[model samples]
Target: MDMKRSLLRAGLVLAVALGAGHLMQKLADSRTHTAELATPQPKKIEKVSAGPQAAPAPSPAAPQVALAALTAETPKLPPLTLLPRLPVLAPPAAAKPAPEASVAPDCTPRLSLTATPRAMITLALNAPCAPGQRVVLRHAGLVVAERLDAKGQLSLDLPALDDAGQVSVLFSDASITTASAALPDTPLPRRFAVQWMADDSFQLRAVEAGQHYGDPDNVSTEAPVSARGGYLISLGDPTLDLPMLAQIYTWPADAKTTADPVIEAAVTEVTCGRDLLGETVQSRDGKATVTELTVAMPGCDALGDILVLNNLAGNVTLAAQN
Candidate 1:
């Protein structure tokens, strides 16, 4: 009985072992079949190895230029030639001047000009002390000069000049003395004036010429009418343009034959160009008054170079306008 029991136990254990082995085999086969039916999957990474590469494309060649064709495009130039030589003539020699003496004349100052004593008798020459020294002077007018001393001395020549503007002295040498003088001032311009009173009236008649030309007031007669001295004093260069002035004393109706009251002169009739100004001046004797008239004309050439005076008085001597 003990042996039979042990055998039954061993059989049971072997059967169980056999069943477990079969189940594992089925599971492994099913897994493998499923894997085979699925599609292939790519790997997570790829690697490159040393291998051959594609060849590069060939490059095109550059176009070539021709040397002969380039030379033909250049411009041609003219050929150069040698110039002919010309003869150079020499000039004739000039004549030489003769040699002069080596000695030269002395040029030392010994005299000077002077103006000192205004009196003729006091006149003296200024020079180095030489008791018997000779002195000289030259002038158009008569004069006298003499030497005085070695230093300062005052002297003058007699009858300096006929002209008021001139004063001259003579000397042997100009360097012996020196002098100075103040020239006189220029005088005011001179002119004459003609006048007419408020009661007087007249028209421009005709021009008067020469001395004693015509009456100042009467132009109806038309006799010789012209200009004369001091009638119209030229203010400018009278020869070119007659710009003049005048001073005329008004006269009373009865003054010609009898004593008339002293009165102021009224310059009315004036011709030079046109009226410039009018003023009053004292009479020469200072006893009465006078009129100083200044006037201007269109032009001396424009007015026939003549002034026609017409007024109440009979025609008077004509005076040229400036």
Candidate 2:
């Protein structure tokens, strides 16, 4: 009897425990039903009007965008390309140079000349400018240009021009030589150039048969110059038209001065820039006195280049063109 009572009590306990579990389960179900009521499922609405319809409301939470779907919908981009790196190259080797040639120093010419008055000129090249260099010598109005050999030593042989004048020699550079000499056999009727001043004084530019007078102020001059039938005439002649006194340089006392003193006395000379004076030589009772000498004037052709008149108290030498 004790054992039966124990078994019935155990069965009652088991039944109570099962009833509690059933009640808890019913409560959980009730709570689930309440939540469902609070949030109802959506129902489709019927369209009212056709024209432009209002926009639909947004859903509570937008559907999560899938990574693959987003990637598919997005526009494709250009593919990226990387440039390759360049290599550093080495420079080329330098070439060998050629041997240089020797050069000479700069040589300038130096010249010297010796001229014996009235004789030819002697030229000497003291300094040689270079190989195959040239030198020039000028005299009167003529030029003599010559070249030198490698040695630079050179000499020039030329005929004499005038008894007393200048000769100019020029080298390739700086050295210029001027020489003067005297020669006994200088040719004449030489031409003489004259520069006359307003005061009737004159200067010699050149001695020539080549003198053609330049334009001078047309005024009267008392100088001992006369033109006979157009000799040395320029700008209507500016010489004395009568016999004038003039001095002759280096006149010997012994030479027969007047071939015919009385008749040849009617003359004029142009030299040494002296003015004119008409004079006479008179001898009364074996005594000579200078009287007023008058005679007929003759042209230039009648007399020689040299007109020597010595009997007068003053000695003067004159020149005329024959």
| Model number with the top TM-score | 2
**Scored by Cα lDDT, where does model 1 land?**
0.34
lDDT of each: 0.34, 0.40
Q: Which model scores highest in lDDT? A: 2
Give per-residue lDDT, candidate 2, residue 94: 75
| lDDT (Cα, 0-100) at 171 in candidate 2 | 61
lDDT by residue (tens digit), candidate 2, 69-187: 44546777899897887877777767667667777755655555565332335656655555545555554433444555677666754333344445665665656766665443544
Per-residue lDDT over 5-71 for candidate 1, one digit per residue giving the tens place of the 0 to 100 score: 7887777777777777788788889988888779566666677686886688768778888676456
TM-score of 1: 0.17
Stretches of model 1 off by over 4 angstroms after superposition: 1-14, 41-322
- Each candidate's TM vs. the true structure? 0.17, 0.23
